[model samples]
Target chain A: MTDLNRRHVLGLAAAGLASTVFSPLSAFADEKELVIGGSIPLTGVFAFAGVAIEAGISDFVKITNEAGGVAGRKLRLAYEDTAYKVDQSVAVFNKLTTQNDIHLYYGDSTGFAKTINEELNRRGSILMAGASFGSELNNPEKYPFQFMAGPDYVEMIAILLEYIAKQQKGAKIVFVNSDTEFGRDPIEASVKRAKEMGLEVVGQIVTPPTAVDVSTEILKLRRANPDFTIFHGYVLAPLPEFLSQAKQLGLKSRFMGTFWSMDNSLWANVGAPADGYMGVMPYRYYYDTAPDAPILEKIRKLRPTYQATGYMQGFLTAMLMTEAAKRTLDAGKDLTAKNLKAALNTIKDFDTGGIIGVPISIPGNSVPVGRIYSYSAADKQMKPASDWISLKK
Target chain B: MRIATAKETYIADEGLLTTRTQRAWMIVLALVLVLAPFVLNAYWLYLACLVAINVASATGLNILTGYTGLVSLGQAAFMAVGAYAVAFLDGHLGTPFLLNIFAAGLVAAAVGVLVGVPSLRVKGLYLAIATIAASFILHFVFTNWVSVTGGMSGVNVAPARLFGIELASPFALYFVIVPITALMVLAAANLFRTRIGRAFIAIRDRDISAEVLGIPLLQYKLMSFALSSFYAGVAGGMWAYFFRVVTPESFPFATSIFFLAAVIVGGLGTILGPILGAAFMTLVPELLKYVVEWLGPVFPNAGAALSPVRTIVFGALIIFFLVFEPQGLAEIVRRIRRFFHLWPFKT
Candidate 1:
């Protein structure tokens, strides 16, 4: 060959060799592995929740692998940081759908979940189990591919409102929420339910997501002095501030929140003041009484950083995912997204043991309608307040 | 002696790939863009539509940052303005898609002019801060102005349609976004060859000199702001229409940073650079995702570590390009062609 031709051949060979060496994992990725992608916001504002969710997923994958995995094959979960940005989330979703054999997606936030639902509806390849309990996620008619790990936001709020109404006899409630979809859905639904139940909604205040000081809003609530305060918001850093401010304002009324406020860290920051805070969750984290509760113990043993409350709830979510995977395998079907969705729909009365008091199902448009858990500031524990309550569809 | 050789080489650097090649490439791009839907899958069409929108936004940003030497991180806010504008018009008046999009752009341009009023005095980091604050203020309005902007729940936008044909499909939207993007890019590219364009270049190099030459500095600055915001507004309209929804969460502060990063990494001050930058910023993370997916098993703790590493690598890559390849990939391609033409001669 001429020198130029020989040089071109050599360069091509070198490029090929480099790609093969650097991307050796790509070769093995094609072999018998079910890649389930988790699109979480690992970098941005919601990084804390994203980390907790991923930790739950990681621990679950580890447990499954140790127990011989699903259908005698190992399970892999990959995560991409959407940074809580829709464009970035869309990019991650595209990467998961186009490049990988990602049958399932998890950990997308509320807005992102809505966007992903629209995309998944377009190409019916991926089914999702996500951290978001937005009412949209539970709309089986709209998003057939999406299944929630917990009660819908509306259900959770209704349950909390109902619990408060029972406790206070005729409690005056105020709904304070960030103006995000995560905060608005529950308040909107619960307020209507509260009116229906003859519980007075004294005041409603909507604050911005980046409100560093919610003192004004707190003052408004304090002035109203509602018997119960339902904080339907995701205030990771500012939650403690809100609680402390409310305490300073001498609002002795009870404070409560949706699932995101169930974290111990939120309570730990405010101390004794956060004592009366209650949150509605799908499962009981500190429960030790059920027969099939070994998974809870196993999770605590493996992930020591995982406390009993939100971590266990997230772990139960992952456990539910594994059980659904097992059901898919039992049907002798390929672990495709469609088959997984089918398997999940067939998940009727899945008893999560003592971890969750009630048996949960996914087939219907209904949520499991979880119970209320009150946080004890002195003990730093979340305990179940009532039995699981089902609501009207 | 080396300087002499370099100076001598500059005369011979001109190649056959001039205006003809440029026009030829544009024609090829137009054809490929026209036929892209027929060849690529649904997902890719979606991605392409996004790319076109980014291209439109970046083109406007390129005019400000690349042509006029300004740094602003409020492009996303402009997009929000355009998107909300489209949503508002469509919801209230039942306006058609094309008219609404243009109206949205016009509104954004108006906002851009309002923001640029401070630019009459502010410069450098001060100007950047002003623009950054403008973005936050815009977000505040969107989040707090519930009656108009729908607060955080976001207004569900109506799809863009023409001649009774709904622009609902990704392919249909692609045709809408791509052609406008092409027109904007071509317009911007050709604009640089005009007096106002040269005036922009002059201002970019040294504002004092341009002002001395009577380029009407304030007028041109406001024009830059108006033009840049118009592009962002159009992109935002596309975003709302294509996604079939609009929420405050869709346009976060990070989006502005993403645009700035795309411009910087793609090749600041060049038309091709923003496109290259947008593609890099968009595609690199995607490529990293597959890489992480494939290598996820190698380390059981891969999920925990891969994302941070990708970000660190992204930062490092940007720095590397800025330091080692300041002219960007476009310049690198130019250098390679130069090298090939000058083959058989030693440096």
Candidate 2:
């Protein structure tokens, strides 16, 4: 052989780089597989929810396949860890969609959902649902291809408002939310709803998402001293301190939260301080053993530990997605976004196998149904405190 | 070995590509760019568009921090200004995409001049802190300015239309983004051949000395800032078009640090630095992602387990480059070119 010089090596490297970049990617999934793509935040700040959500989706897919699949076509999950960043989420969307014949997608955040809405409308192939309960996404006109598993943030707060209206007439309420899109999502709408329900809006306090020492916010809370304090847009932080300090000051205000912070395991970390803390949750808890909830029982048998509320949300989202797919295929129509979403809208009084305490209907983009659950320090669980309340009613 | 290149005239001597080989290589690059979209898959095209946007922003950062020696953590903020401007113009006025991008650059440049007023009084890390403060102020404005920015909910951007065809997909956008990035990079490379560019260099070396050499420090500094922010603004406009949404949280403070790190790691003060740096920075995470996927069969839950490790490896790679290759990947390129120039000769 001729001398293998550095020039030859360099030329070969350049050729390799070009070929790798330019090589066409073939479709990875066969026609029999209905791919469910996900931009899951398996890392970064949202990883706690992400891990559970991934497991939830995976378990649902496994269970569905074992039960004879959706309309005889196996469900395939193609996902990537986005680390909860919008750019990464978009990147994952592009990559997964390009590689697979995806008809359903699960987004991670409100930002990603919103950012990809235009693209979704343009593609008209995939229908999306996500962890976002942002009030803005509730509009089907703007986000036609997108839907959520539960009530939007506003409806979640409205459920709480309805409960409070029944429990105590004209209850003075204070809104404590973080300074974020997620935090501010339901404040304005919920405030209007609260007034409509004849509840008095006492004060609104906005704290930075990174606020570790909420001393000043607590001082504001003391001044408001409403009958009920509703916290939004936060998963865990500052609420524990807020509750502990409010208790220290002997404030009689009842602390409440929305879906995200309503998880029993999350509040259990605060122990006795989380006692009597209440929030609106759209789904049954992991340990919830109501006679109607066969799905929860099946979930418990699969994993013998307390699953976070995120797991339930993910499991239910997957269940709804596949149900839509099954409906579309059952109608003998193509699996286009329009067909899938149209089929989804046709769902009324649908059973979630007791994932929800009651039969639910997707009147629009959201389930618009939730029940108030109070955290008990003694049992370390969120016990149902109210009957299922639907926004349509 | 080949010894010397003879220049016949002053024009020939001052030319950017003094050798025929360089011009031929440039032609090859141009050909590659022209054919890229046709050959590459959608995922790669998407990445290419993203890399182009990042390259544009990183080049702007390189101009200020590398050429003018004024550090800024406000590049992302300037970009945000551009993105918001494009979104507003496109939404309200229904202006053409090109005009919206150009107007966005002008708006960001004006903001840059205001932010750079402190740079005259402060240099080095102090100047960096000032830019950081400016970034925070801009973020607050983006968040609170409900009428213009749509508050935290933000506004959706209409896809760019070129001659009545919507450039919505990454495949369509590749042509728009890549050519614009190439032109911007070219303009930046040509900037160093001008009087303003020389002034920037002199200021970078020593601001007092540059002043002694009859350069007005504040004017030149502000000019540099305007030019840099203009570049960043244009990049941000492109970003808005690509993503089709402009939220307040689009450009976080961490993004500024990313561009700064790109400039430093790519080889500070070099023309080729930002291009290579931005591409390297953008692609490395993607490469790491593939590596994790490859490890999936061997290691269980590798995607989840190695996700954090990918971030650590990214940080470590930057540190490694800073330690081992201070001049960056550009220097490596130069060394390889030199080795090729005298190949097969034991000099």
Candidate 3:
């Protein structure tokens, strides 16, 4: 052998390092295993929802495996943190898909869902669901391989509007939304729907997502002085400020919100100010003691604490994905996007063991179902105020 | 080892590759660029395409901030203009993608000229703030211009088609994006050899002195902005093709800061700086992912616990580079090349 020089050693070490890092880590994957890949936003702005979503998916995977995974195949979850960035999310997507035979995917944001939709169609293998309830992704013709766990943003707003219509005839309404894609998603559609329902829309207040002070917006809200104010797009923040300021102004308008802002624990922190605040919730609350909910009991036993609405969303998403896969396998078919999506649509009035409070069906890319819940300060919980409302009906 | 060489002509002295070794290395680099798509996997090809687009944009930012002494935070806005232009042309007119990209560059250049008018009055941080305001205005236009920009939903661009073949996959897009990036970088390198480029450098060194030398400040400043934003617009067109969708949220303010940071970290005012800086910045986060994965056995929830650490580490690395290698990665590369040139001999 030739003499071992320093340069040769360094070159060899670099080669070894590259090989170790780039080699396929999934080479040892079992044939009886199915992968559920995710681009999770475990860090950055959406970390709160991301953390809970990760846990919910992980817990579902574990529970399914323990009970013998769908069609004798074990379930595996491979995920990376995206920091809620579109490019980073795409990178995570490319990395995970390259390493695994993933048939199901979970995306973090609307931007991600849109960016990856073309790639999903090109692959023709993977079906996806995401944290985004953007109304744009609810089209079956455009996005055949993608679905959301519950109602799209517009449908959520529609559910709330229906509730308002039932409570009062031609109630004057105002919309307060963040100036974001998510916030603006339901506005135009909900406005039209509210008009169709004979409710008068008085004003629309748009605020920046990061606005700390809503003094000007409050002035606008005071001017409108509608019977009801519906807030969308934000998880927390300015809502509390809006609530407190609206109270100080002694405005008679009842405040409301949609899916992302309806969590009981979130409003509980706001105390009395959040009391009587209402919104549309697609899934049952964690502490929901309804007689039909076996899933809630299982969840409570697994973790003795209140899970966020995001957790319910994630859990329901996993359930729907698994059910689709199971139905595809049961029909002795390959898990191609077409077959799996067809199987998903076949889910008519499927029972969720109390997760959804009522049997849910998937007519298209969305469930289009929700119930209005009001937050009570004394109990610090979102008590159900309306029966389960399905837009499909 | 090369000791010294005497040049007989100015052309010889100013040559991009004066030494024989450099010419040989250039050939080798060409070969590697050609062979890379074949050898790299799908994920790496995706990253390569992304890096090429970033390099193009960062090179544009470097032209403005590093060479022309004009700080801008509107690179992303310019890119958005290009992306939207391409999206509209491709979606509405069904024109060829190359034509769409060229049109995108022109539109962005026009906007850049408008935005650059303030650079004549304010500079440094003030100029940067002005650019920031411009970006916010552009963002508002993109958000509210419902008829043209598709409002908040944004527009989806179809895959670039060449000879009826769709360039959808990373492997296919690699051919289109890489060559365009290479040509843009080459054009930037050649720019400094011209009178306009020299004027930019002169303005960067001292505007009053440059004015004394009879170089018109407004003309040169606007030209520099146009050229820089043209480069950015072309890159954004490539980005639109690569991502196949362009939303208002796609090119946020943070991305502008990202390109600026890349220029500083890659060694500003150098031909090779932006390329090195963009590649280094892009790969660092990806490398950290591997590092986190490697530590998984030792720490089960390392993904959650160390995920935030990756951001911290990224910040720390930037700081470390700023403090230690103030001139950036290009200087380090020069030192290594110089050491190799005079190997076995003490400098």
Q: Tell me candidate 3's interface RMSD.
A: 1.4
Residue-level lDDT of model 1, residues A88-152, one tens digit each, is 77666765565566666775677777666666776676777777777766777877777777778
Clashing pairs in 1: B266-B277
Which has the better TM-score: candidate 1, or candidate 2? 2
The lDDT-based order of candidates, best leading, equals 3, 2, 1
Docking outcome class, model 1: acceptable
lDDT of 1 by residue, B84-176 (tens): 999888888898899998998999999999998888898878999999999888988997798879877777766678898988777888888
lDDT of 3 by residue, B150-234 (tens): 9999999999998889899999999999999999999999899989889999999999999999999999999999999998999
TM-score of 1: 0.83
RMSD per prediction, one decimal? 5.5, 2.4, 2.4
Q: Residue A235 of model 3: what lDDT?
A: 93
Could you estimate the TM-score for every candidate?
A: 0.83, 0.96, 0.97
lDDT by residue (tens digit), candidate 2, B118-234: 998999999999999999999999999989999999988988998999999998998898989999998998899989999999999988899999999989999999999999999
Model 3 lDDT per residue over A1-393, tens place: 999985699688678657844676557366798899999998889988998888888888989999999999999888999999999899999988888889999999999999999999989999999999999999999999999999999999899999999999999999999999988998998899999999999999999999999999999989998999999999998999999999999999999999999887788889999989999999999998889998889999998988888898888899999999999999999999999999999999899889897898898999988999999999888999999998954
| lDDT (Cα) of model 2 | 0.91
Considering lDDT, which of the candidate structures 1 and 2 is the better prediction for this target?
A: 2
lDDT at residue B149 of model 2 (Cα atoms): 94
Clashes of each: 1, 0, 0
- What is residue A50's positional error in candidate 1, in angstroms? 2.6
How good is the docking of model 3, by CAPRI class?
A: medium
